[model samples]
Target: MIVRPRPNWFRMLFVWRGSVLPVILPQLIGTTAFAILVTVLHGRVFAWKIPLNFVPFSLIGLTLAIFLGFRNSTSYARYWEARTLWGTLLNETRALVRQALTLADAPSDVPTLTARLIAFVHALRHQLRTTDAKADLERLLAPQDCARVQAARYKPAMLLLMAGEWLADRRRAGQVPPALVQAMEVPLGRLTEALGGCERIAGTPIPFTYSVIIHRTIYLYCVLLPFGLVDAIGPMTPVIVAFIAYTFFALEALSAEIEEPFGTEPNDLALDAMSAMIEATLREMMGEAQPQQPSGLPPGGFIQS
Candidate 1:
C-alpha cells in the first residue's frame, strides 16, 4: 500500500517508527548488557582481550543478507498477489456492466442486476479479509436477499450465487439473450477466480518452519554479535549491537507483517478501499449517482481506482 519511495534514512528510522521499537527493544537491551559484561570481564579479571576476525563476520553478514533478501522477496510476492486479485476484480466488474448493457435492456431487470452488482462488491470486501462488515451490504441488497446473505455463512459467495440465479432467471424470462449470457459467464468465472486467489493467499502461507528458522537465526546472530564485538569495541558494544539489532529485527518484523496482505495492518494492501472502488464504478455503470466523498483519504494514501 505504501507505494511512494521514501528516503532510506526515513525508512530506517520513521517509516516503521512505532513498530520497530517493540521488535528491537529486547534485542537492544540484551546486546548492550552482553557488551558491558565482555568489557568488564576482559579489563577486571582476564587482563587479556579477545580479537574479532573480519573474515568470519563477513561470511555471517553475507548469509544474513541473503536471508533478509529471501524474506522480503517472499513477502512482496504475497502483497503483489493481493494487488493482482483486486485488479482482476476491477476488470471483471467493468466487463459485467458491459455484458448487462449489451445483453439485456429490460427496465425491471436493470435495477435488479444493478443492485446485485453492488451487493457483490460489498460482499467480497467482507468475505476476503474479515467478518465485521455488513453495513454497505445492507444498503445495496434487497431486504430479502440481504437478510438471506446475512444469515448464510459466506456472504460473498452467497451474493455470487444470487447473481447467478438472477442471470438464470433473466435467461428463463427471455430477458438476457444467449450470447450475452455467455459473455456474462466470463466475468463471473473471473469473479470466482479472484475469490479463490484471495482465499488461497489468506489460507496458505510460507511454511512455519521457514519462519521459525529466520527468527532463530536473527536471534542467534544478535546474541552472538555482542560476543564478537565487545572485546574490540569496549563500551561501544551496546550502541553497535543496538544498531545491528534494529537492522535485522526490524526487517524480520516487517516481513512478517507483509506476509499476510489482507488484514488491517498498517502495511497490508487496501482491500476495503479497492472493493469500494469496484462498487462505485459498478454503480456508475448502473446509471446511479456517485457516492459522496468521505472526510478522509483511504489509509496509507492508497487509492483503489
Candidate 2:
C-alpha cells in the first residue's frame, strides 16, 4: 500500500499514486467525449431533440450518490476488518512466542516453534495474496517442515497443525506443562480465527449483481447527463458532465480497488509490511539480529505486495 505521509491540499489535488484516476481514466474520457458530442448536437440527432431535462437527472443523481456512498462504506469496512485481523495476528504471534520462551523448558525447541510462527505469518500473507510462499517457508522452516508445508494444500493451516503437534509432543514428553500448553492453544485458536476471517473476506466479495447494477446505473447517468444539461448549461454541459462523471466513476473504481484489501493495489492493506513487522518483532523477541533487508517496507516507504 502507498505509505507516504499525507500530501498538502495542492498536492492532494494532483496526486496520482493511490488514486483511482488511472483505472477510471478511459471511462471518464469516453464519458467526456460523449458529453461533448451531445453538446455539439445540441441534444438533438437527425432533427429530433431528445426530450430530457435536469429534473430527473437531479433526483437520480442524489440517489446514485447515496448508493455509491453506501457501497464505498461497505468496501472500507472490509478493508478495515482485514487490517484488524492482521493486527490481531501480529499480537497473537508475539504472545505465542513470548509464552513459548517463558514456559517451554526445551530452549532449542522454542526457536524451532518461533520460526514456525514466523513462517505461519508469511504463509498466511502469501496465501491471502495467492502468491508463492515456498521461498519464505524454506527460509523460515527446517527442511522436513518446509517439505510438509509445501506439500500441504493450505500451507498456513498445515503449519499451524504442525505447531500444535509439536506442543502436544512436548507435553507428552513432560517438557511443557499442561497449563502452558493450554495457554499457548489460545493464541493458536485466535490465529486460526484470523486466518478464516481473511479467507472469508477474500472469498466472499461484494455481490456481483449489486456491483453490476451500480456500474450500469453510473454509466447510464453519465452518458445521458449532457443531454439533460445542454438546454440549461449549453457549452458548459460537457465540463459539468465530465466532472460529475469523474466523481461517480472514481468512487466506483475506488470501491472496487479497496474491496479486496489483500491485493497489491496502492490502497490495499500493507500485508508485506505487516508480515515483515511481525517477523522482525518475533525475531527480536527470540534475541536474533534483524535481517539485513526486511521485506515489509519497499524502497519508497510503501508496501506493494
Candidate 3:
C-alpha cells in the first residue's frame, strides 16, 4: 500500500520492491518483443491484415470488460469482509474491556482481563497469518496458558474458549451479575460471528472456474492484439501493444494483490498495525503504560477494502 498524496505512475515503472516485478516484467518484455516482431515482419513473412474483424474484437473486449468487472467485484467483497471483521474485533475489544472493568467484582482482575483480550487479538492476527503466536501470546497472557494456547493450530478460536471459561468462572464466583454478563456475552457472540466470517473468506476463494476464465481471456486478448493492429499500425504496433499489455496486466495483477487483504504484502491491509492498535487500546483501558502508536500504512490506491 504505497500511500502517496497523488498516484505515483513512476512506482509502476522499474519498481522492484516486491513480488509484482516478477509478474509484470515478463509481460512487458514479451509484449515489447512481440510488437517488434509483428512490425518488422509485417507484409513480409506474413500478411499484415488484421487477424480478426473489428466486430469480433469489439465483442471480445466487451466480454473481457465484463469478466474483469466481475473479478474485481468479488475480490473487493472479500477484502471488505476481512476489514469489516477486524473492525468488529476492534469494537468488541473495547466493549469487552468496559464490561469487565465496570461490571466485574474484582476490578483488580481488570489487568488480567485486559491481558487476555490483547492476547486474543494477537492470537487472531497470527491465526490469519498462519504463524506461531508463542511470543505474542506470552507477552499478552499468563505464561502457562500462553504456551498451551499457542500450541494449537486455531489460536484465536482456542483463545475464545479460554475467554468463555474465564467469564464463566467469574460469574460462578458471583463476580459478575447475570445481566452484566449478558451484555458481555452479546459482544462475544458478535466476535465469534466475525471470526467465522473472516475464516470463511480466508479459507474459501473465488471459484477456480472464474479465475481460469479471466486469466485465459486476458491472455487471449493480449495475444490477439498484435495481429489486430499490425496492418494499420505497422511499425507502431509494438509500442501500442506494449502499452495495452501493461495496462491490462497491471490491472489483473493489482486485483489479485488486493483480493487477499490479510497478506504481508505492502499493498494488503495493515493487519499488523491494526492488531497493535487493539493492543494499545485494551492496555490503555486497563491503565497500563501505553505503547507508542505504530507507524502509518504505506500510500496505495487501496490499503484497505
Candidate 4:
C-alpha cells in the first residue's frame, strides 16, 4: 500500500501517488477530445442538427452517479473485509503461539510450533497472491515439513493440519491438559475461518455484468455529454466534459484497483508488511532476534508488495 504523510488540502489536489488518476488519464483525454469534436460540430451530423439538450443528460448523470456510488461501496466492502480477516488471523496466530509456549509440558516443541505458525502466515500470503511460497516454507519450516508442504496443493491448510496433529500428539502423550488443548484449538479454528474468508474474497469478484454496465454507461455519458451542452455552453464544452469525466473515470479505476485486495497494486493491502509483522511478533514471543527483512519491503515499514 502507499504509505506517506497526508498532504494539506491545497497539495492534495495534485497528489499523484496512490491516486487512480494515472490509470484513467488516457480515458479522460479521449473524452475531452471527443467533447471538442462534438463542440466543433455543434451537435450536427451530415447537416442535421440533433435536437439534444442537457436535460436528459442531467437525469442520466444523476442515475449514473448513484450506480457508481453503489459499485464503489461494494468494492470497498471487499477491501475492508479482507483487511479485517487478516487482522483476525494475526490475533489468532499470536494467541495460538502463546498458548503453545506457556501451556505445553514439552516446552522444547514451542519453537518448532511457532516457526510453523510463522510459515503458515507466509504461505497464506503467497497463496492469496498466487505466488510461490517454497522458499519461505523452506526457511521457516523443518526440512521434512517444508518438503511436505511444498508438495501439497494448499500449503497453508497443510501447515494448519500439522499444527492440529502436533496438539493431538501432545494430547495422546498426556503432555498437555485436555482443557489447554481445547483452548489451543479455538485459535486454530479461527485461523481456518480467516483463511476461508480470504479465499472467498479472492476467488469471487463483483459480478462482471456490473462492471460492464457501469463502464459502458460512464463512457457513453461522457462521450455524448458535449453534444448536449455545446449549444448552451458553447466553446467551454470540452473543459466541462473533461472535469465531469475525471470524477466518473477515476472512481471506476479506483474501484477496480481495490476490488482485489491481495493484488500488487499500490492501493491494495500490504500483505508483505503484514506477514513481516506476524514474523516479528512471533519471533519476539520466542525470545529470538528479529528475522531479516523480506526483499520487497523496505526499511521503515513501507510495503510495496
- lDDT by candidate, in order shown: 0.74, 0.88, 0.76, 0.89
What are the per-residue Cα lDDT tens digits for candidate 2 across 240-278?
998999999999998999999999998898887878778
Cα miss at 89, model 1 (Å)? Answer: 1.0
What is candidate 1's lDDT per residue for 94-138, written digit by digit as tens? 887777776686645766766776777667767766765578767
lDDT-sorted candidate list, best first: 4, 2, 3, 1
Candidate 4 per-residue C-alpha lDDT over 1-305 given as tens digits, one digit per residue, 9 for 90 to 100: 87556788999999887898889989998999988988898888788888889999999999999999999999999999999998887899989888888878988878878888899999999999999998898889889999999999988999999989888988999888999998999999999999899999999999999999999999999988988999999999999999999999999999999999999998999898889988988898889999776665656443432
Rank the models by TM-score, top first: 2, 4, 3, 1
lDDT of 1: 0.74
- RMSD of every prediction: 3.6, 2.5, 3.3, 2.5
lDDT of 3 at 285: 83
TM-score of each: 0.84, 0.94, 0.88, 0.94
Better of 3 and 4 by lDDT: 4
Show model 1 residue runs off by greater than 4 Å. 1-13, 16-26, 29-54, 293-305
Better of 1 and 2 by lDDT: 2
Backbone clash pairs for candidate 1 read: none
| Candidate 4: stretches off by over 4 Å | 292-305
